[model samples]
Target chain A: MSPESEEMMWCHSCREEYDALDAGTCKECYEEASETEEELKREIEDLKSKVHFLRLSSPIESDLSPSDVSLHASSDRKGVYPPVPAHKIVLMSRSPVFRAMLGGEMEESRSGVIKIEDVSYNVLCSFVQYMYTADTLLNEQLACELLILAEKYQVKHLKFFCERFMTSRISNDNAVTNFAFAHRYNSKNLLESSLALILDNISTLTQREDYKDLVEKDPRLVVEIYEAYLSRQVNTAASVKELQNV
Target chain B: MSPESEEMMWCHSCREEYDALDAGTCKECYEEASETEEELKREIEDLKSKVHFLRLSSPIESDLSPSDVSLHASSDRKGVYPPVPAHKIVLMSRSPVFRAMLGGEMEESRSGVIKIEDVSYNVLCSFVQYMYTADTLLNEQLACELLILAEKYQVKHLKFFCERFMTSRISNDNAVTNFAFAHRYNSKNLLESSLALILDNISTLTQREDYKDLVEKDPRLVVEIYEAYLSRQVNTAASVKELQNV
Candidate 1:
């Protein structure tokens, strides 16, 4: 409309006029970036199709394949649950624990029935389904339970999946509990994030019941938290001192 | 640097100074594009891990799983090649043809051996390997052979893979042959690309030996090519007349 407005450059992306101060990349860079984005999107589509093609129909969802092995989740209060049918090849392929257990001359391999301790029937079903599809719907509780099972059976991908889910769901409310769980399962990512969250809210740490319970159950873990907090405090103080010196 | 040079804007990406005419995007659009690129990259990484998790070791490559089925590729010159061992569930999952044959009371299902006629041993092995892993290395000749097997078995993913490979290798020399092969296999992508290449070099079409052979073997295919070329010519002439009127 105006001479000044006409002189303002328009963004090729958003098509909005902006001053030189608000400039981003040049035309060549912009074209290169756009091409890179398109190439990345194409790669994503190709990989997604490959995942779809490789994914097998879960045996629990279908009875097409005669399952050679069945998993029983042993429950103390409710008695034995119904067996979760799975293929030995699938289980072995997914987990080295299962591979060793099923591939060797073990009694469970001979019987073709595996008795898993301390996991619920629902959790076991989801676990087996993940082995087939590399996918699962996860709430916080399921994430925690599956992480434990994943850690025990050495399913690194599932363990990483659960850890990422748990990390996303981390809050001040469950920071202490998640910290303990992460430590137990050797989830480095979860441990770092949960510890960071706990230290960020260190003043209210002792007031929480879970924090107090963790203090009583595992005083060493509580001490580790304090050590991290103290180390952070020292680093901040030293940085401030250096700033004043400069 | 001169005062005028100092007044020039620098790209955030390449850090090169550019004038108003060379401007790309505003700061907001640039930041958003960067974030989108990062998200796409993260998604690609996630899908790649999922693919790795979902990929099963080919039974032909491993002795871990006791395969319940074997495939014999019947060759006229070499006689019957060694049976390619594969899991029934894998075959059934990958191909509907295999599913129908294995799931029902077919002779192959009853006997646990499938006879694949008119395919070489190497091609059959690669086909079975692809069923397990959703991957195979392909040359032009192998891609053509595998496309035929993939078509017969109705393994759409493998067929698509081979078609994509063949399409990439399409040249003026092979366009006629590939066009016919694509038509026979109902490979729309390969057919379109090969036909485009053929039309681009239509002057030399009848001069090639393959073109002469195609005319003798399938005259209807040659007619279809001429039909496409004539349609394109008509569309061009109409556009030229419209431009002259304008």
Candidate 2:
């Protein structure tokens, strides 16, 4: 094709001249795609607003009067944190564990007070906040802490949220630790990502302090990791052999 | 280009040979567009799941015990409908009107029982359900009912939801009526859509029974519609003049 003819061609998106190989979509398809993109974006905006609308104002934030239930975060020390006010309906709806505790003929239900032991005030507050809003600002430390709380409470949504955050942050340094945490919590998504990271760095796995700790604390978990690594290797080899035959 | 050369030209999307005039995007741009589409879809899925997680189960369905407040629908009849149970926190969070009634030392707040007058049991139930779930099935009638209830309670989200439904269902048949409803409710979105529909069929508008009623009931609204029509006409005339000069 001549340069003059090439210059005649235009992109519908950026509206610049392009070679046939540089073309994206035809005019009709581009218009259709633009409409679809707009529609998808509008849907995202609508869903976001819905999420905002559904998010309950946190009891702590609202300073709501006459909250039905109060949760106390009891540390190992004698000093107990101030009570975290919440409702039984919200607590039960968010977690089956909370439901079992608050819905049944339990002392917690009767007294309208539940003691959450071994958790700091911050984690307990964040956990309750997440139940109301389905959101929280998370760091690695917060994610790990919240993941434990989420798992214990059986709040699958928050567990998944924290697990996803932790999984994305997984690296060679924390792979073994994350793998162990995932295994303990039964977070399948986190477990897979962490185990894959561990498998990728198998040569340097034992040198990590967490690896030694895992081995001491749970030998079976270490053995299972090795088994997964071996299975992946065998699968890779089989795929390569099949490709060679083809 | 010869017929044989034309055979080489193809669209990546529809997989069809096309002339230069029919050319869409190039292969590289097509691939990039595909990636963008996939990312948008993934985002949509994530948002959808977040919405699902955030949606609180309606109290009616859950049969949750220990509900803190009760809503009674009082019709002028001798028999009052059964009270709809709900949490005060949900009510306050969802509606500013409910918040004021419940949050302050109002009669409802003191008694823990709110008598919602003029709404039937079904509409009141659906209203409560929407407050919890952010969802309710809607037909034209239902949407109208819900929109009224939503506006009365200052539930902006639900009011918007119903307005959108009403707007989508607008036609020449109902445009004038919906326009009046929108004006009454101060629903700006619905008002715009309904007014546009009315303007589009302005030739036959005044002949409509609702238009006559609106003229008799509110001459000011009718005059405003005419003013809007005149402004649009003036704008169109100026645009035409500019095009002719060019």
Candidate 3:
């Protein structure tokens, strides 16, 4: 090797030689940064262990759940499902709506039997499982159903989880329907994301079936979309004029 | 600057010129490391939010806790203390012992009252609060008391937490007592750490008051310590002999 090339700096991390222009951090800073990374990794491990410790086993994990209360899902199509047992403390702790319902002078509180209307047995079971485990597998349909249930019971954690799931799945096909759903449930994250996707594909908006359904069901949302489009056009024109002046 | 020195590399992190000897990492490696750090930090934040969502507010934090069960600390000095209200589900979820006691046809479950003997009222309250919050302010005295309670109830999470606290505070003076305590409570982490400390200070072992007390209280533990020391000595001697042979 030439003398100049022989004097090239080497990276402690990748163990590769680099030219002067490719330098990253000095030895002291590298050591400090490595320490910081290790500390962060250790913290993540600790938090993971804590989460595992905090998570309760789902009632379905055992035949006898030792539950103090039972729930019946009263569905229109499937009829009254078998009773799902749950702990009162867990129910109350996870949702303020449940706390109020179970703590007050209500028949459900007295009887220890909560009858939830308009939800299928599967949805009800998943919701109760999420209360114990703080986790659930979600598809598009499950996310939609859970978001509504989360909103109804005021379970902010589950609501946020569902909103995040739905936001990631937002696309041209489902944007209109998701936007309407977001507005109905007051899900700000989902609403903003769906609006952005809809606005980006504004030229092809009216052709979609969900768009026609939204317009028929909620014409005010369609008007708001046009207003937003107009506002965007005006802002773009203002920026163009300012640039021309400059 | 000299031409040779002017050719030196500059660190992006510390922003200082460095020679080949002081080189740390290449630019690509540094960027990748930075991204990994950011991802880990984001994960930590997510896990923290989950923990916050899972943590239940202590019933003691409220004037009228919607508690269905109450605990009384039967203290030796003060007799029965004021009832500390708690939820059965919370207790049962945290500890298998509590689960068995509350789930079966136990008198405490039937009466909705549990008597915890051989603990102060303050300690009982703190234990219940920790069950809810997964946190507590700890001193050596409180750590010892809570460790005992955690062991009796088989609350592994709290037991590990107390063991960590006591391990951090292990020193020459407390080594003997801590070793004995760790053994009694089956805290393997604390026991190993305390034993290591005691073995390191074996030359002055008999001079400490706690060491003498341990010898009187449980001479078998002292023999075990000596056995461990002798085993360590034999290993060291073998390694030294192997080196000499080489």
Candidate 4:
């Protein structure tokens, strides 16, 4: 055989000729990997169908006959918006706060009217929809609002969902604000990531308007940020000194 | 280098040496495949969480304040079983049969009691539990019983679940019985597999008691099985003749 032929091997996957040095796996492993991929795909299909089966029709979308309770987003300036209809069982099942309020002899339980203070009408609707379906289309503003509500209701799943969305959207502009919000909400993951980003850009931290506001509104949070920055600096200095000694 | 070394290739996955013929994929493809597998796993995790979030507390398990409807499994030999508590909204959302029966002027709608005939209490509880959680532990008997109720209620997900279980458990001893059950229930996948298994064991068909019962009770099904066997034989003979001519 020629040198080229000796050096070349056919790829089982892409079916192209690749050099010996670029070889991936033995044929046995390739076949086994293919089988594993197939099994994973089948499992994905099964889980997808299970999700479809478990998803309840959002009460907001469907004309479900019995919505036992109604929720209003209380607004001081605009008065009360129309009630967002919901099932008590659904609310109770999803949130411990709702369960306590509805399961006990609370005013909300007796009147079948839940007054959710300081939430917008649209946000309230989305919240109720999520209770039924465990899904919602979210932007940054909506995610933050819903995160607060989820936190109050003790809906851990929705709170985590919102935190994930907000964390993904974090940037230099929002890192300080998000860090403060994360701290307030006990969002450890969001707090850590935002603090890391803030520390990375520590030179310009004092110049931003949000930074000044954070120092005024929550001076303790500002101190924590500085403490983290100082700790990182000490660790870096220690590493450099140890390297020099070596 | 030795000839042995010259003829060998390394598997990136298992880190083992093998011949050129045993080669699987190139390095690039292997890395890409690994990444793809990781992505698939992450997707599975996300989907599993979604399933968990969507799963509702079965009314049977929880002392939920309001259960709008109750179910009784009517048995001929035994007296009526205790009521299985459920929410109307859950029943309506899961099955169209329940939607029509409860949504309209049906007797079940007026009384808030649904009488499920020809089902045992254990099976009834399992059926309602699956309605809420989309899960159940099934033996062969339970699978068969739930499948019938699932079929009656037009709960396609549960029906498919039962069909998959029964299909996995099909054997020579039970093939004829399952074929009849699958046929009666319009289970195409189960019917096809059971029919194929029967055709594979055509010579022993008359020896089985279930086969004799099937011949006595549903002669048409027996005739259909024989027809399928003859069709397979003709196709086999045709393929043999083609090979001989070649």
Among the numbered candidates, top lDDT falls to 1
TM-score, candidate number 1 = 0.96
What is candidate 1's lDDT per residue for B128-234, written digit by digit as tens?
88998889999999999999999999999999999999989999989999999999989999999999999999998779999999999999999999999999999
For residues B155-222, what per-residue lDDT tens digits would candidate 4 score against the true structure?
99999999999999999999999999999988998999999999988778669999999999999999
Ranking of all candidate structures by their lDDT, best first: 1, 4, 3, 2
Residue B191's lDDT within candidate 2 is: 96
lDDT of 3 at A81: 57
lDDT of each: 0.90, 0.85, 0.86, 0.89
Candidate 1 CAPRI category:
medium
**Candidates 1 and 4, the one with greater lDDT:** 1
For model 3, the superposed segments whose C-alpha errors exceed 4 Å read A1-7, A60-66, A76-80, A236-246, B1-6, B63-66, B76-80, B241-246
- As for candidate 3, its clashing pairs are none
Error of 1 at A7 (Å): 4.2
- lDDT value, residue B217 of candidate 4: 100
Q: Per-prediction TM-score, please?
A: 0.96, 0.94, 0.91, 0.95
Q: Which scores better on TM-score, 1 or 4?
A: 1
The runs of at least 3 residues in candidate 4 whose Cα sits more than 4 Å from the true structure, single-residue gaps closed, are: A1-6, A76-80, A241-246, B1-7, B76-80
* Better model by TM-score: candidate 1 vs candidate 3: 1
